[model samples]
Target: MTNPIVNLFAFLSLLLFVHCDGSDPAIPEDHRFYETMMVDGRARTYLLNLPPDYYKTNEDLPLVIGLHGTGGNAGQFERDYGLTEKANSAGFIVVYPEGIRSNGVLGVRTWNAGRCCDFAMKNNIDDVLFIRTLIDKLVSTFRVDAKRVYVTGMSNGGMMAYRLACEMPEKIAAIAAVSSTMVVASPCHPSRPVPVLHMHSVLDAKVPYNGGKGIGGYYFPPVDSVLGAWSAANGCAVRDEIRNDDDRFKLTEWLNCTDDVMIQYYLTRDGGHAWPGGQRSGNWGDTPSTVINATDLLWEFFKQFEAQ
Candidate 1:
């Protein structure tokens, strides 16, 4: 089935933009709510952005949890991904979780991601449990629609999203992972398969699209293998002849057992291992040289799914 709204946007210019604070670009919020959460007896910080309409609406709003990559904090997520502006306009509550670092490791913060990140991967820290606990706390305190919770992330964060799908499918409705490959190893499948949207650049030197080991001090699963795993779990059919606008990128949308459960694969021609249109800095290496707006693409994909 064709998406009437997305079809309309296809002809029109896709305008993706961002809003950043002048100073402290890392800390994306000025007056947003935040908290320091203790996970596994460690102090971790997270920023919460309640929509302006949060007070006005009687109905519960959807919640989106964002995870940052290694060597990044929540602030970088806010400014780099342009999620603050996107969340503000969409009227959804956005959560940014900070990764914990071990014993004074300079510029190193990573999620265990099963195969990578020595501290997270080797120590057997249960990040899925932490995220579940965090969601439980948020739902109790705020009027979050439990059925509509979503997750998105970059690199390590992307891997975490895959882990969450495997571990907490009932809790998360959908996920969007950018420039990151799946890294969790689980024989068990999701209790309820969730929708997934994966975007990656074919030219990504860090995480190869064709599926080999990851470069730049990170480990990840093969993209095709991960998709195959999800397909088997969800019982989705593989489609030939991809649907896309141009050769710049090719998109394959898979419909699972139910129409509600969908998965999309976006293969970019020469895009790199970075959030499209994300902010640039000397500290954060491999920022996409091109100016593509991933925030807009994420929202466009996210808007299509509703809570079960």
Candidate 2:
């Protein structure tokens, strides 16, 4: 033999390299990866975070689509929203979808949530289709549980979440909106009753709690109006029912709805337009509430329902 020991050493070295390089051969071999798809003949980009042991098993994990607020990009939202860490711990996959950029800025972007946004709204960008197609693409590319797809966002992104629920209820199992309200002028209608969870702070300057012009100069309807619309669309017996209460926050819900769907809202006395228990966006960003971990609550809510 030329060199049997050397050959064994080389083989071991090759295995080490393969282990370090993640030789899974999956479309996304890394835990945190990127993928691009075409929607409306336009290139759309998204960042994906898979659970740490994702490639270790053949599990079909649930997917959570996180949308950024106005003037935000996917990376920034991913960093500040605290979803990736939650995904790792909860054994779910989370993706942050980038919105179309505004003309004046490089990274600043907005979503076409129906109305009251900047570039995307003015151009009437097809964000709804983008998200719907994104879900389909994820299902095609990854081992995602199609029936357990959930969506969540903040501010403008949250409004976009509302829009998606209104337009494509069948594709989504449930939705949770934070610091957002339905700004779509069209009447609410869905193919089926979709479960909803909403969280807000009474003191939020942007997306004001009682309805009025926000710090972004966008006019909003009262929270009651938003809940009323959702309740009626889901065929709830009542608009709001007090479920729980605390000094820092109050829990309201709509339980008696068609198909047993439920709607829950959390109004916190503290905090502003920020993700509850997430890192504050910036030095000047609103302080998130400390009472509840939204990531945990949303996952708890999301795990209960599936698309039927």
Candidate 3:
């Protein structure tokens, strides 16, 4: 029989854990109102931007969800990637979601993108559900095209994007991950074929182009392996058609997939763990590549698919 004192202690420990897990710092209200929603009894926050013509037009706009790297936030991602400006010109809504903070702090944030992250993984946060719930809210609150929802991210956020594509293909039409790869050990089984676009640099020191353990002992798959797995999963042609876009960039495509789905890979000869053709903002160690503008390329790639 369980001792009454032990049972009481166990109950108190559970209460403390719940309280600590649910505690989160207040979100700052910059130009973009830091929006929050309760997910799994914890407060999740994201920044939503509508296109300039959104209020005037009745057309359903595409929704792009951007995830940031470890130790990054939604506002920093918006500023660094300059995605909001692109969304304004392209007529789409961009949502930048904040990752779970370490000890409820503002900056030091991380996503539970699988095996190789910090606090989020340690605490076993349900980031997938948080994103799904956020998408549901955005779809209903704004004029979001149910068929054109997309996801993208940098580093850990990029890994999270891959996880989303693997797990939530029904809701996410396509994904464009930068400086990230699939780190989950379990086999990915998407409900439907999901178009994928991967951008990486051969010189990435943080997450190596070849598979290896990275900072914080995070094991990352090689770029080739990730592309190969997705191609097979999407039933694309076994032979990848490759093209040299420029001296520093190579484009590889896996064609003839089920339901017209395609997997694309962009390889930059240089630029280590940085967003290709993005602004250098903070100390995220992202060396912007001049070979191609990632935002333009990803948007072009993403426009080809719509959720079925």
Candidate 4:
């Protein structure tokens, strides 16, 4: 008999997969599926946005893995962040990974970003391993620059980004956490220096810049504590001078790191736990104009590091 799994998966695939039609299509038409695999026995979908010239050339391109926040999916990020558009224009490939969810609940997905995740938090999911497998698949399938692989996430996804940097520092180039802080059982001490950019809103009641009273009713290490741990691991000097932006976001930048790995913090005064400069997704109503696009600012930060 024909495999029922294959048939069901094919139907699901048809519903999820769509071709990119634009002045610059990211993935090649011939390689539309990109690839697929299951994690935790659940159907986790991911979208691979290829650079326009991927099919035309063999030059390796940077790969960016964008993780979505809680109650989010890959498609939402693909449209809201416009990562596909950015990847097509910037000559990089973007991978949008869907988070695994549990029974009966629809659309409420979250990452195993250590502390949060009503389901994943209890299951002890191996998200780091899942990411490693995803990376291995992409590297084998396309001309991905091994040294230029980066991770960025929003909210819970941002926490996952920090986890990756802590556990897989050698594998990633750098990381940017937007409206998310680090969540660790103990503390994350990276073996090697990984550049990090943390952008958060001072007024964020939900994952407050000062820390306690997390969104999911959990406690996490404060922002200052998280930054201090990374600084210690990365061997950054304690900055005496603090810089304040027009938006009331204070930054204490640690300059001149080994191998040019530096740490920059973007603190916005009025913007709440929202992506520093991302579109207000109705969650944080009426964000200010001074709030810069987190994606653009993150791209600027990520460009500073090269695979060493």
Candidate 5:
């Protein structure tokens, strides 16, 4: 299992990312491509970035799907989340699934993500099924390792990632939720235990870390309560540990969980309702945390597990 080539590959990948400026994660194109598929009579779209030298390999690669917040599209998430470049350097396939433009409140693109978002939520969009079907297709076409499939997203998209892990635990190996908390209705009965890594900012007002309504006067459940539910579901020990990293961010972990699953959170003191260690949401979004790059943390967490 100890391969020098693999270790060197990982080292070079990290080196490439360290040299990148968090504010600008976009890389030159050629390997990035978009694809559309019909799900439930509606045309769903997604953008994907393949790893460098992808064509030369017969190996099955891990797949990571990044979802954007409300008012964001595949391209925005692809850029803002800073996952595409990671995909290229880290040798994993990355996909950005687009949300539908809503006709209801907000009147903008959003994921249903259970009962927590606009448009998609109001209309009862089958985003869960759409994502499931998309995963199936992508896995078949790209030789993806189904057990290594992972999901990460921001805001509403992060909530959607929670929904997927809750409803389709069999398909998702793990999930990393950013700047968002679990808003899915109670009784989040997953078929099996799911590993979850949540990252948020203490200063995030859009989705406050302590809970209550945030942006657009939307109600958000307490982040601790949400994590508590997941830990309890995973049969993790009651006690949790919290560690401070030079006053920049606090790391909390539930050490003993059933199935050797990991349940942890990274609450950064810097940054607001935006991704930590990446560019702001858009031109007018909040500044990202300089203490840590979320993309780096997400991948590090994701690489540790596969579907159990």
Candidate 6:
């Protein structure tokens, strides 16, 4: 007779494979589908949100891709950032792309945003290529305005935004990074000048304002250095203006760049390692600031530019 214990173990292994087959479940009519793609032999997933008017009109609309931070998933980012509601009101499409998970769980995801971070970086995953492919897929599948594609992200995701701006400037019109700095060592050379906005908090302990090694041995360049590099690359002038300065928040703009590409920075007095005016997504260490709504401000900034 055959060994009963061995047969039971084999049956359980088959069950586990079925459970982890990477298929999406049925999504609600109001909610977007959790889509998956095969990139470099790895399965990648992302959530897409279309505006209420998407089906109502044939007009081409702008697309914004939002990247999640390390140890954060696309679902959590979409829920916490509240961009879908904003997209409905503003008439744009929004996408939240999930990063590779180190532990194959929702809470341990990380992007290969260059030299920093965990599994994605160690494995040398080409995240920039993946994002470019995602953009192409969305543009062809939806009524995406080719001249109005933009990107924004939080922490590690923010760093990925900068990487996209550097490598895919022709595709991305602008980028907004919150609580993140450029971690790449070499100078960034974009095909064209791209508008950029950075938001940070003075009290952020994780990615220090001045920059250094952060948690998990991730070395972050100083925020100023990050902005300075972009400014120089974009040929921005010395013209700098401070807007919306108060006890809570200060906005600085570097004007007169090539193609009118403005580089802006927002410094919040508080809100350590958090998206300004966003909900704290449990134990993520994001202390939202009350000074400014990042989604509103970034959308306004993004609307000012189109791909040249």
The most accurate candidate by TM-score is 6
Cα RMSD (angstroms) for every candidate in the order listed:
10.6, 14.9, 8.0, 8.6, 11.9, 8.4
- What TM-score does prediction 2 earn? 0.88
TM-score of 1: 0.84
Worst 10 residues of 3 by lDDT: 13-22
> 261 in model 3: Cα distance from truth in Å?
1.1
What is the per-residue lDDT of model 4 for residues 1-308, given as tens digits with 9 covering 90 to 100?
97888765533321111111121124446534434588657556677877778889879989899987766667666766667777888888889876665443243556787876555667777788789888988899889998999999987888899999988888899999877789865568777899988887777766777878655456766777787777777777654246665755677687667677888887877767555554555433335325567788778888778757
Clashing pairs in 4: 26-50, 249-267, 277-292
Give the local distance difference test score of model 6: 0.81
Please, what are the lDDT tens digits per residue for candidate 5 over residues 79-128? 66678788888999998888876653433567888766766888889999
Pull out the clashing pairs in model 5: none
Using all chains and alpha carbons, the TM-scores for the candidates as numbered come to 0.84, 0.88, 0.88, 0.84, 0.88, 0.88
Clashes of 5: 0
What's the number of clashes in each of the models?
2, 0, 0, 3, 0, 0
Where does model 1 exceed 4 Å of error? Answer: 1-31, 216-219, 238-241, 281-284, 287-292
As a whole number from 0 to 100, the lDDT of residue 298 in candidate 5 is 88
| Model 5 global lDDT (CA atoms, 0 to 1) | 0.80
Q: Compared with the true structure, what per-residue lDDT tens digits does model 3 show for residues 26-118?
A: 444332456879999998888888877887989999999999887667776776678989998999999889887777343357788877477
lDDT string, candidate 2, 1-308, tens digits? 55888654433321210011111112456677776788998888788888988889998999999988876666777667688888999999999888876665233467888865767888889999999899998899898999999999888888899999999999998999888888985877888988999999988877887899865456877877888788888899966888778798999999888888899999998888888888787555788888887888889999999987
Candidate 4: deviation at residue 264, Å?
0.7
C-alpha local distance difference test of each model: 0.71, 0.80, 0.80, 0.72, 0.80, 0.81
Cα error, candidate 2, residue 131 (Å): 0.6
What lDDT score is found at residue 223 in candidate 4? 76
CA displacement after TM-score superposition, residue 49 of candidate 2 (Å): 1.3
lDDT of 2: 0.80
